[model samples]
Target: MIMRPGHQQLLLPVNPFFLWASLIVALLLNMVPLGRAAWLPDLLALAIVFWSVHQPARIGIGAAFVFGLLMDVHQTALLGQHALSYTTLGFFAIMVHRRLLWYPLVSQALQVLPLFAISHVIEVAIRLVGGGIFPGWQFLIAPVIEATLWPLASLLLLAPQRRAPEPDANRPL
Candidate 1:
């Protein structure tokens, strides 16, 4: 479909398999031992939020909860910690999904910042309740990183679904 200037083309329907595959890759990336850089960004959370915003029907709260459970298991943290956080994130994403669709990519990222922060807050609250010590202000860095990476993540994930340009059909003979 041809998109007029200043207007964005609607995204094509995404494959369910591709959606799950991207989540799996994000999970693996999250699992990579980055040592000190472990706080870099939560790729898994980013993927969940991305899909939750763009394709809520396919990746809803239940999916976020499942992925969060998997993350908790992989990290050996409190079993339900990630689950609650992700579910909350998904809720916020769904709430703002339509409004988000109208903004440019950078604006969308900016808009989602609060959702990312809320997810982190949920995780921190869980940790605190479990008698864990404060992880320090540096712990807040992940949300900022995740928000910053939003555009890149959207681009990469949507590349396969983007339509190719049409040939010129109105050219003079």
Candidate 2:
């Protein structure tokens, strides 16, 4: 479909099942035992931010909170940390959803940097308040990585929603 002057590409209607399935896959990715690279990008957070921006009605704060809680349980971290982070992230994403939709994927990633950073900051604050030792500057790397991966995540998650190419009406028969 031809996008308007101020708009990004038009996406086909997304299937809710596919949406949730993507989130589940992100959760699974987060759960993988990466050992030293355990501090890698939060795939679930990236997915949440992507969906919240692209399809706010389908994925909102409640979904983020639930997924955060699941991460808490799975990681055995303090309860509600991820929930708070994700809820805040969702709120900001929804706040800018319309504006964000106008940008190309790479630009969207640039715009989303602060939202990802804010979520990481919230998590850090919670850990600090909970008396967890500072995990060092390296702990800050994940948000940057997450932001860097935003475009790829957007492409991956939106692939199914992209409309298939139309047949050329002017083709010579």
Candidate 3:
């Protein structure tokens, strides 16, 4: 049975269940006990990029807010600390979303790096104001790593599908 073009475009084989599942996996990756710097993956950022570029309507600032809250809660860092920063970051991401969606992998990584830095900056400002100790330049390292990983992350995460277009009655079949 052939699917209509609209139906084909609209169909979601996995629904949101799969999307949330991927996010959960990202959460796990974030919460993993990785003591070393080399092994860390910017799981949450990567997932946000994936969904932002591919499914902005489904995942946006709101989702980022919730996820940030979750990160704050699970990591026991700060309550609204990450949430505010993440929401602000998400706003910019959404603002540049059209460019992000069309950008080549390397370009996307380059652009997103600064955004990752911006997000981190918000947190750092919060920490600084709250009398958190100077974490030194090491704190900058994670977003650098996170930004560097975007190309690979996007490829692995998006997994684009270009299915054949379905029939339309006006065109010859």
Candidate 4:
């Protein structure tokens, strides 16, 4: 493949096992007993958005819904609360996936900030509708933190695919 300035090296195909494993790890991170602080980043949501943007075909609204439901069950929140928010997040991510990839990671993070904010708004709105008390202004921090984590997430998640098939001194990928 011919290289263009600013174009990233071509990535190898994503491994299915690695993909699922990343999601599971994110879920486990969420499951940690952190007392559900409003400012805490939603690891599962971050991972979902990451994968939805990078590999839309493999991680779409359906997968988001499933993970959301699991989160609801774990948190004992209203049924479908996380589902609705995560589905919205995944949908928006997929919608912008192609265009988002054209920019540098920092720009991509900026683009995704709104998606994370919207997801949080959806969750808070649902909670409010269900008579839950206001979580205060601190809730606003979650989206920003999630956006800040975007560049790190992209580098980490794509690491496996970025490796050369076989290290060779003679050939540069």
Q: Estimate every model's Cα lDDT from 0 to 1.
A: 0.86, 0.85, 0.72, 0.94
Best by lDDT: 4
Error of 3 at 80 (Å): 0.9
Instruction: Report how far off residue 50 is in candidate 2 (Å).
Output: 0.5
Alpha carbon deviation, residue 49, candidate 3 (Å): 2.7
TM-score of each prediction: 0.89, 0.88, 0.78, 0.95
For lDDT, candidate 1 versus 2, the one ahead is: 1
Q: Evaluate model 3: give its TM-score.
A: 0.78
Question: What does candidate 4's lDDT look like per residue over 92-155, in tens digits?
Answer: 9999998898888899889999999999999999999999989998999999999999999999
The local lDDT score (0 to 100) that residue 152 gets in candidate 3 is: 76
Residue-level lDDT tens digits of model 3 in 1-173: 75433352433333477677788899888888775342354578677766766677888889889998998898676687778877877777778887675556677888888888877778778878877766677778877788888877765654433222464777543
Clashes of each: 0, 0, 0, 0
Q: After TM-score superposition, what is the CA distance of residue 51 in candidate 3 from its true location, in Å? A: 1.1
Q: Total clashes, candidate 2? A: 0
| TM-score result, candidate 1 | 0.89
- The total of clashing pairs for model 4 equals 0
When 1 and 4 are scored with TM-score, the better candidate is 4
- Mark the regions of model 2 whose C-alpha exceeds 4 Å error after superposition: 1-8, 36-39, 165-173
